[model samples]
Target: MSVAKIALVGCGPPSRRWHGPTLTELSKRGAIEFVALCDLDETLAAQCGEAYGVPHFTSVDEMLDRHPEIMAVDIVTGDPSHHVLAKAIAERGKHVMVEKPMAITLAGCDVIIDACQRNGVHFEVAENYFRMPKQRAVIDLIEKGILGDIVRVRYVDAKAQRPFEQTARIRGLTRPFSKFGNSSGMCMDMGSHRLSQLRLFAQSEPIQISATVKRYRHSDEFISEDWAHATIEFESGAVGLYETSRLGESLAHYQITGTQGGICDHQWSHPAIPLRLQMGEEWKDVPIEFERHKVDGVDVLSRIVVHTDPQIVYVNPFREYAIDDWCVGHAAEIMSLADAALNKKEPEYGLGGRKDVEMAMAIYESSLNGSMPVKLPIAETTSYERILHEDYEARFGRPIDAK
Candidate 1:
């Protein structure tokens, strides 16, 4: 079988923890081969390349030239650079799987979608939550009319302690790839997962998004929002509430209600934990458990080997529990991508080229503009594209071809 050549951009944590291993495993399985590793930092490029046994390049153009058969680009760049790199990939006629919040702003997202559409290339927002076993099970329940008509949803993704204080510095280790703060805030950083999942659960497009964003203290290190709570009105008449913060340490929680019954999942728990039926009597936690396998071969006994003695075996994917998080849904996304690559069937995750960045922009715009209820399905000509085109032309002193 011919190997699918891929260029990996942004050597961040996701790249190291998720994309890197997945690609390596795919390479071992003859699914795809890493042709190049690109990063702004020469050392990181060299390190990642050496680790993966792929060539390292500080310049993407050079990598493309050396390996013109590149079929895909794995992009994990920060928000500001996402569009620029994605646009380049689209122009080059390469499939792209990008990490969310698709683009920093609405217009940036439009440019990406338009370019991909015109280029006839596949674009997928690497949203893993939608593919999680428990989450998928809940979605299945909802789809089967088990929950009946969806009425309301409350999603709270809170941490027990301040995230910035604990994880910000560690996260900033990848700052060289892009402006860390550009997409580091709770709003775009973590909120995207919740919002995207909400849309999937509702199985309908949102009509309007009203958001309230704030930063209690100023930090030059990061420029993105720290805390945000958003309200969304779906076209199906489902009202949703989403709250996120770099500070919430109590619990990572989720709850959804319908006319018939309700479902809930708490921190470090399974979506199949319990199903409560609103019978004539009362709501009770029905004992339902689904065997959730952590895809990265993680188990209770593996902890000592991975943490206490790292040199004894391969790296443990569950160091911070994010291993289970990514492993929870990685197979779904990978299988989906593989199917699209081989069978020519559109996968649910951007298989038809859904404009996720457009949705993201709508959320950002709603937040930026005083939380006014902004309509969904924003036009392709968003303000960022308009304003940026002008700025680009002015800066270059020539008409710019954004397409």
Candidate 2:
């Protein structure tokens, strides 16, 4: 197999904790030629480069110019930088892999798509939740008719206020929710991942959405919503309820109810707590077995087996590397970009990332219009999107789509 020569951008916390080590491990295992690291912050780039044992730079242009062999670039930056950086990278004739919400607004996403199409480069969005081993097993079970006809998919994150409170205190609740920040809001941040999972679990397209987004605790300075509730109507007649709050009661509930059976879990993707299936009158635990081996003094997941009828197993393609279950998602993401760049094939989740962003935008649009149901494919730019664009221009002194 041909290894992709890739460079990474953004040396922030996510890069240090996840992307840096994951890329290092993959490179050590001969998966990819991890070329270099870049960030606007020279100190951060240098720190990550030293830790990962790679050259570092503060400019994307300089990095690409210096390492012309790098075929794809992994962008782990904030939501606001996604479109700008992706467009620039694609224009330079390199494939792009950007962290998700693909872009903060549909127009921004369109900018990226247009740039990549014009430049003849492919791009993949780093939405990794549904790519995990356990999630893959769950999806496989659903596809195999273990859960006949998914009827409802629900995700509720109640009372997760402590982390949000700490963030507010550190960043100062008085800090304005700006366009250049790491997060757009609750709905666009974690909501993007949950929305993507909901659609995948139902195996259907969302047709309409009704939602209410509000800020109960934070002051006006925090323009983003702290609480959001969205009801999605899927094309396959499946219903999806997504309720999350940075301030509220504490509970994590994720479930998929089908005609024949149901799957329930307290947390979203906890492999430790075996998934419960309700085929009969009572709920039974679906046994999960984790296969692991030592790699470079680290216990990496070799594969995960879900003991369902006939058995559902997800073998780690990168088991030879030191990748834990969580990093498995990240590894899959990088490999997706590599496949697209080297094989001249579409990504596993190519345009699906845009759909995820559209879903979140629909929820916000519905809330902006008094919880009115907003139809899918959005048709045009939303008022909420206009607000975001205006905010971007105000903060950066240029339009979001400015070259």
Q: Across residues 5-92, which tens digit of lDDT does each residue of candidate 1 receive?
A: 7778888878888777666666655655666778888988899888988888888778888889877787887766677788888888
Candidate 2 whole-model C-alpha lDDT, 0 to 1 = 0.85
Which stretches of candidate 1 lie above 4 Å from their native place? 1-3, 163-184, 248-251, 268-272, 292-325, 351-360, 367-370, 380-403
lDDT of 2 at 11: 87
| Location of the lowest summed lDDT over 10 successive residues in candidate 2 | 167-176
CA lDDT of each candidate?
0.63, 0.85
Most accurate candidate by TM-score: 2
Q: Can you list the residue pairs that collide in candidate 2? A: 159-249
Query: In angstroms, how far off is 282's CA in candidate 1?
Result: 3.0
